[model samples]
Target: MTKPGRTLLKVQGLTKRFGGLVAVNNMTFDVHEHEVLGLIGPNGSGKTTTMNLISGAFPPSDGSITMNGQRLSGLAAHQIARRGVSRTFQLVRVLPGLSLVDNVVAGAAFGYRKRWGAEAEQFARGLLERIGLGDHMHLPVGSLTYIDQKRLELARALAGEPEVLLLDEWLAGLNPTELQEGIDLIAELRREGRTIILVEHVMDAIRSLCDRCVVMNSGAKIAEGTPRDVLSDPEVIRAYLGDE
Candidate 1:
């Protein structure tokens, strides 16, 4: 676990483009160790693109990324994963044919290739329990509810034992109760001292769960501060169309 004073990840002038369009433009930020930093923006504001850049899904068009003070600008996604960064997409990415526990085990196995075999299984099993999916361990991911699939995605990310976790709209499509439960699960992860960068449009979740928020518009950051302050900023309000 990272201590409070450490900077888990830092982004400087990060930008991404596809042909003529800039999806993320000259953005920068820092995620403190063990802190939940929320990333919010309008639908096309490049939030997911930003997540992709940070997690090494693609190299940036320009700029730098660092994690635990190690340069991460050009690494491949798997290499970044091996270096203690993991992520979950807004769309759950579980392997439907595999059991929920088996899916987590695959992640744990990759991250713990150097550990003893039994130890890896133990770690995977424990992670499933921790993420509240222990009872569904034997069930195929295809049979799980959407909420449970979400949980499995989280469990897979956690199984990697990442130093920084990028969560992309983990609450989307959840029912009210499931959303609250998922919020509580995120809080539980925070308590475990994991550093997180969360991209969520759900204002209630942002207010209740984020330590601070970064708001973007038109593929560029517009404001960042405490949730209350950011939410009330005239620019942020304008960007959100007054909570459209």
Candidate 2:
């Protein structure tokens, strides 16, 4: 088992309301350094909403978010990103017009430590190579197949050198083979001790990659613990499968 390090990110009493509808309600969780924490739940459970709040896509209506004990809730998206938080969207997003290398270079130049010029290019290339996109570095992002596009997005996210990485349903649309490949790539990241908050429905990936899991439903956390314990909890089962 991988023992978690100190708490790197903390989400406390986080809530978001779109008018009368609550997207995330009083949600709280901690992500430890060098640990992969799975945020798993049924559809519309606010998993992605929680991720957005942490990554600064949207501010919380109530509560706070902190990283390394520093407040992050009020910062803008770019500001939060520069503070060592990076994320991939539930929908894959890339600069389609840019070449693979340039797209990743953008991430390197703007994110975290902020590399530039040839250094940024070199760093981007190395990340692409690590993600298996090196051979296609010069290709336009739109030209790659769907799975490869997903790979490119990951490389870009990693180029930022984030202390905390958030992945929202990253394995959603893959075929079995592609899913396995994706799982393997994530597992490799875990071995390197990356701190990741993964919002996923894939049970196999959740079981294999997560050090702990926080399960939610209707925008509120319902269970949290090791994957084995939470997945078997009666409340969690009821949330996913409903009352019999």
Candidate 3:
């Protein structure tokens, strides 16, 4: 089976600015198919802004983004998602009134609108089981623990069948065991041939999961290399320390 990470998503000259403040500065990178690329930075480093641009939350100030040779510039978020891209937010977006199955079904519906009828619900049920939420299929999303909610978000994104999945701080609030589970889940996704681009503050996850990493400081790409190389660079170290 062909892996999603084997394909390449090219982001070139991607820049975004709010007035005189540049949130992302001419950043360029490639997310390889079937690989995990970790994106790390301190507060206000434009990590979220970069994710927003690539996911089509807004148009880039100046740049071109392409996936599988398709131009992604000027597309809306949903449109981009339909084009084989999906993202999980830092805040965990799920419907409180919906059941676990329903939340994932909603995601399936987004990509399978034309295939409605019994098929949609059937597909959602299968996906929920695959995501390890079979037992909670009928439980209200609001009643699940925080960890379960995070899993729901993952299942929703997975429902899109995206070639590229962007995870924004997915492990932020988890305890040690939960964090490990999340890490293993992501790693398993990679093994299942999914490509992932993760923005995280957790160094341990980045170190264990990413094949390569990109470091940003103040909205600019300061370094891109192996985790050890970038993490140990004097410049990168100082940047983390708030020095120029």
Name the best candidate (by lDDT). 2
Indicate the residue-level lDDT of 75 in model 1: 91
Q: Arrange candidates by lDDT, highest first: which order?
A: 2, 1, 3
Clash-forming residue pairs, model 2? none
Model 2 residue 40 CA deviation in Å: 0.8
Model 2 Cα displacement at 71 (Å)? 0.3
Q: Which predicted model would earn the best TM-score? A: 2
Q: What would the per-residue lDDT of candidate 2 be over residues 56-127, giving only the tens digit for each residue? A: 899899999999999999889999999999899889999988889888999998899899999999999999
**Predicted candidate 1 versus true structure: per-residue lDDT over 54-135, tens digit per residue:** 8888899999999878899899888888888889997889988776766777777665243336776787788888878889
- Where is model 2 more than 4 Å wrong at Cα? none
The lDDT values for all models are 0.86, 0.93, 0.85
Give per-candidate clash totals: 0, 0, 5
* TM-score for candidate 1: 0.94
State model 1's lDDT: 0.86
- Supply candidate 3's per-residue lDDT for 15: 94
How good is model 3 by TM-score? 0.93
